[model samples]
Target: MELSLHIILEKPTAGVAFGLQKGSGNKYETVQIQQTDSGNLDFYLTVTTKGDRLKDALPRFGGPFIQGPYMGNFIYLDIGTLAGQVSPWNRRLKIPMAGITWEIIDQLSADVALMLKTNVAGTAKDGSPNCATVKPFNGWRVVSK
Candidate 1:
């Protein structure tokens, strides 16, 4: 059997969609997407900083500085019926950031996907957000080159 899944992370605007101004402060810099597994788009979103400025600033900020990109986890559930009763397929996956995890939720001709929400520390509210429909580069196409 062959099964594959695709996941995309999108912002609420066209500019954010293009990664123009996503990071906060001067820490924001260009990052290369490092792939761990291309089959599921598993990768890392990282950024680089110049000089020891970040190092010196850490003391002032009173905390240890962690560089980008932070990884996240993914969880899956399967809702099935047994003996005319509903049952759950308890499944959990530690899907690192830029990773995808999938499992058959049901045997019927139905599609299943999971949506997760992580509370983002708010940045400057400069523009309106595309909260209604936030999508990846191609609506769901997550990988490019």
Candidate 2:
């Protein structure tokens, strides 16, 4: 039961498209970026997964955000269910500049694969427990046109 997820950061349109592909299945459960808001650039995602169309997964799955050092930024997707819980499926995606798009995509894909493997194996990937006090991503560069 291998699971793979891919996210394409659409720069020109300031949107994102991601899909989860299970083993041997060409079909993918996709999440399209419907809208973005100020303050952490919270993504309002429309998810179609497992025969369910979730109009908004943010409320349940937690919205993703971006933050990083100068000249680079990374998006973080929190899969944790609630505060003070350990999240095995948390994903951190780096937003690449125009020149390094392919590299970033490969990296993110690998990360997603590894996370899925660990989750399926029922092994805990050591990490700090999710806390509410942590500050949200301050930079909101991605804007909708």
Candidate 1 lDDT over 1-145, as tens digits, reads 1112333322222222111122334544322221211122222222221223334321111111222332321211111121112323211112222322122112111432322222211112553322211222121122222
The per-model lDDT (C-alpha) reads 0.22, 0.25
Instruction: Report the lDDT tens digits of candidate 2 across residue range 1-42.
Output: 122322322221112222221211233222232222211122
Query: Worst lDDT window (10 residues) for model 1?
Result: 75-84
TM-score of each: 0.17, 0.20
What count of clashes does model 2 give?
A: 0
Candidate achieving the largest lDDT:
2
Give one clash count per candidate, in the order shown. 1, 0
Question: Looking at candidate 2, what is the lDDT of residue 85?
Answer: 25
List residue ranges in candidate 2 displaced over 4 A: 1-64, 81-91, 97-145
